[model samples]
Target: MRRAIYTGIEAFGSILEGNPKKNVIALPILQEVSDLPCDTGSELKDLQIEIEQKDLPVDLRFVEENWSEKSGKYEPTSEKIRDRAREARCWLKERPESEIVVVSHGGFLHFLTDDWEDGHKFEGIRQSHHL
Candidate 1:
């Protein structure tokens, strides 16, 4: 599959301070952002609950690999990040679309885009997660 990389976030915690409902300028290409988490504290779940209270159009869909209420990375220890990527690819392939926007955490993007690797063009992204 062909792909092009894009920039959006600075620090993971910054997303928490952001308001996706009225602050669409920060997030584009989609009215929704898939809260990319591997069961980690993306802080999006708490926000989701809060957003639901007000009834906003900014859709926040949590992918199974990236959401946890207990805390810590809530992902399966056995599941490699690539596995999630494969599943996502298959799922997207089924849905025909000319353009798709995938909103994810830095950790997920680091591994998925493999942009953190030396010589990678997107090495400009801040490396907050080691692995």
Candidate 2:
């Protein structure tokens, strides 16, 4: 029963609830609806634990390979993300039934989606997926 209380609002969130109606997935840095970016390294660590506990067959696309610890953000020109998107596109063309979900920090998300909306501070971005 992992729980979190976001400080500013003094709000509480139950980290994980049992047997969500649909597929439940976590993208460490990429909390789809979170207004704030994830703290460094925590999302990755949490995902590792989730994957291990669930025995999920997730195909991680080398998110950590070129990441910089000091910079605390993905490379501005993310060749890897672009490359993976291309690869996934190619794969999807081969098999349309398959779906690919990318989980990443806001910094990386910016590179991937060209969406740098000032950390989505106000009127946060919304998506079809939730983590």
Clashes of each: 3, 0
Stretches > 4 Å off in candidate 1: 1-39, 42-48, 60-66, 69-79, 118-131
Model 1 over residues 1-131: C-alpha lDDT tens digits?
A: 00111132222224524554322121111111122332224345554565467543343443232344322333322134545555556665675655555655544555545566544422322233233
For model 2 the local lDDT of residue 108 reads 43
Lowest lDDT 10-residue stretch of candidate 2: 1-10
RMSD of 2: 10.6
TM-score of each: 0.42, 0.29
Candidate 2 overall Cα lDDT vs. reference?
0.37
Give each model's whole-structure lDDT: 0.37, 0.37
| Maximum-lDDT candidate | 1
Q: Between which residue pairs do clashes occur in model 1?
A: 37-66, 38-66, 39-74
TM-score of 2: 0.29
